[model samples]
Target: MIVTRDLTKRYGRTTAVREVGLAVREGDRYGLLGPNGSGKTTLIRLLLGLVFATGGDIEVLGLPVPRRVRDVLPSVGALVEGPGMYPHLPGRTNLELFDAAGPGGGRRDRRRRIGEALERVGLAGIDRRPVRAYSLGMRQRLGLAAALLRRPRLLILDEPTNGLDPRGIREIRDLLTELHGEGTTVLLSSHLLTEIEAFCDRVGVMDGGRLVLQDDLATLRAPTGRVVLRTPDADRALALLDGRVEGRDGDRLTVRHRAPDDLNAELVTAGVRVRELAAERRSLEQVVLDATTTTSADRADRAGGDPA
Candidate 1:
């Protein structure tokens, strides 16, 4: 649904994005992971045609960006940094104004569309209170409702769960899952590693204005050729698999085994009382940290200049 080739963006002397080749497929819940000053927001703006690239190409929904952004934008909904709203107006009013300003959806169904959008974001019973009176989470939900007002085919979101509690975050995740199931392509950038790990199918990591890694989440987090075994018979298991055991702590043993099931069966058959056994896998945090060379603060200090 979105593709870029050697995409570059520069701000005066500083490069915000450099040589980024991004690929987001249709019906994909792709997560863009990066630290501050990593150019994630800049990259998103480049893809949405809000900021023109310094070099390279961009395509969204099969159309060249900026050149055909108008054609592509009708099907694309985005929330970057945050949503803009009229502080004096209620949430419903804010959505109504946004819908009217947009290109798609006629006036005949505008009211229904507004209500449905609000309901989808869990603000169905909202009263006529100004947006300034709403909590941070409520405003966040209102922004999401505005994005969904036009039933966009592609959702490009940045820090989508910025001001929400755990429950609200889970609600948004479930809502995105439902949309993905129904054929909407989602590209969301977030610093929340756990959220992305649990929700996204594909992931891309950015650092120092470059896309350092891109792959399916499962591939990036493949098993680490080891198993973690918890058993009361730790001594017996260690004796039986002395050569294969790598590390041990109390009743838990880290065994250098390729197949966890085979290891479990071997232990059970040997009269070792096994409590739990599972394959060891690299967590998303490990993958991201291994890919990125610098922290946001380190990058900022090294650059000694502008923010990406």
Candidate 2:
């Protein structure tokens, strides 16, 4: 439901996004992962037509951006930074005013939709309370409820789990899963890879204004035959393997290979009894860190600056 090609955005002399390409299909629970200044928000803004791209093409919900923003925005629900709230107003009243401001449902239908949205975000009982009294998690849920009021086909959220407790985080994750099950295409931006790993079907890693990696979480986490072994003689193993082994944690060794079974067999044949044989797989956080760090280092090289 969203597509971009060579999308670039600039501000004066600085480019915030560069040649970023993305495609999110129907019912995709996609995550955009990046660090503090890696241009994730810039790309989202370009997609939303909140900011014009300096170059390239973008189409959201099958309509060209900026040109079609007015026509398509009503069908797209977004909580980009955070949901703005009238702190003094009751939660339900806040939603009511929002619906009244937009081309939303009539009063009767709006009330029904508001109730449903509140219930979906786990804010059903606190409808009559002022938003100022709500907790950080409650406010986040309220934001989500506001977005879902129209039953939008596309949902975009930035850091929806920020400041949420563990239970609240779980709540939002389950809610997103439920929405995706109902065929809502969601594009979520978050710095927390664990959360993204748990909830997102596909992920795109952005860094230095570029999408360095994009793949399904399942495919991304497919097992590789690398192992961490605690052995009786680490030095002896390294001698046998001729420096092919990495790192020595006292008597432990980390070995990378296409076939860990073969390595284990060879180690056993060489009279090095393995104490532990555990697979070494990169976590979601590690994958993201590696991608963004590489991109940042490359940028530093091009700019003739010290690496961050």
Candidate 3:
């Protein structure tokens, strides 16, 4: 669990996060979405106590950050920007060194824990090649493996799937889902809308270094009062529905109906051959676009602003 109030972080004249009130509950697959330099990474760092905030409060796992960050860090796993590793060392050796440097975990079980983590990240059969020889996707997996090294109760991941192919992404998603099912809370920050849409239960949107929206994903994606009716008898269905029909394209009709089941029943009774029927809903993309302003890059291009 994580909570922040009026959490503002500034680098000189540049504000990376402003007046942000973030709440991530236990057992939540929370997705933090934003454009490039939108303060997501900064916020993550603040929560992890990796960066000090200019103003406001931060709480992670029920402890005040920075002051008590050390107490809760053993229970927290994070991958920010990317995993730092000695390129000349093999993946296994890098993980060994990382585990040794971190607190908690018994030294006797380090090898077994490392092996399990590697297996979970699809690197079970990885050879003794140095990390520098691994592909981008492989490196990403190694970073994730590092995060999962301790099976922390909370995971704070930024751009977790960066450089991964579709299959790799899905594998990671499944792995995270499995971890969530085992009571691990996930705070995922990514630019990939589809990944967030598919994996997250709640979402938070940030813009201009501000927390613009935070709510349940289902509530944000609530269905519109319209049903998409696909039928071979589009003209007939349109005639049957009359003024309720809002738009039509070929065999598809967008009808202003509150109940899709009732609409389908009426269409069937009226001899309309319905091919498919579903309620229209707002997509994560639409919700994010509506909540956010221009990207930080765009803002800088116009005014030479500071990066988040």
Candidate 4:
């Protein structure tokens, strides 16, 4: 439903996004992952037409962006920074106002959609309360409700669970799953690796303003076929497992591709007692870190910029 080619964005001499490309299909939950200054937000802004790209092409939902963004926006719902609203207004009123300005529809339909959205986000009971009185989590949910007011075909959320407690986070997760079940494509950018792993099937990793990797989540998060051994005699164990040592963490050692049984047996034979031995898999966090290793040059390359 979204495509980009050589997508570039710049502020003066520094490039925030460079030569990034993606093919996000329908019925997919695509996660955008990156580090502190990795341009994930900048890219999202470009996709939303909130900011024009400096160069290259973008097609979202079969329409060229900026030019056709208005046509496609009816089918798109986005919760970017936060739900922009009047704090003095009641939550329900806020939603009503948003619906009036939402995709064109009948008044009765808009009212029904508003009710459904509030109900869907668990704000039906307390939507009468002023938004100023709502907790952070409540505000977040209310923002989500506003996004769903139009029953959008595409939901683009940036850190949708930012202010919620664990339970609230879970509720939002379930809500997203429900939307996906009904065929709403959800695209989100977040630092919450576990949450993304739980919901997203595809992922795009960004670094130095470039999309370094984009793939099926399972393939990208695949195990490294390694084993880790935690032994008291780490030094001796390291010596015994010479050629197999991948790396070490404190008293723990990562031994390459060898079976635990083989490592255990070898350690025993070499008189180095093993405390803990288990198969190891590269974690999502590790994969992200490996991909986005920032160097002095990468930092220097960034111009401390955000899209207008």
Clashing pairs in 1: none
The collision pairs in model 3 are none
lDDT of 1: 0.91
Q: Candidate 2 at 85: error in angstroms?
A: 2.0
Candidate 4 stretches with Cα past 4 Å from truth are: 228-255, 258-279, 294-308
lDDT of each: 0.91, 0.86, 0.93, 0.86
- Candidate 1 lDDT over 42-96, as tens digits, reads 9999998899999999999999998999889879888888888999998888888
Q: What is the TM-score of each candidate against the true structure?
A: 0.94, 0.84, 0.94, 0.81
lDDT: which is higher, 2 or 3? 3
Regions of candidate 1 where Cα sits further than 4 Å from its true position: 294-308
Better of 3 and 4 by lDDT: 3
Q: In model 2, which runs have C-alpha deviations exceeding 4 angstroms?
A: 104-106, 229-253, 256-278
Kindly give the number of clashing pairs for every candidate.
0, 0, 0, 0
Model 2, span 1-308: residue lDDT tens: 99999999999988889998999988899999998888998898888888999999999889999898877877888887777889999889989998888664577788899989999988788747788998888888889999899888999999998779999899999988988888889999999888998989899998878999998877777666567888888878888887567666888877776677888899999998888877777788878887778877888999999777
Q: Which candidate number would show the highest lDDT if scored against the true structure?
A: 3
True-structure lDDT of candidate 3: 0.93
Q: What's the C-alpha lDDT at position 8 in model 3?
A: 99
lDDT of 4 by residue, 6-58 (tens): 99999999899999998799999999988768888899889999999999999
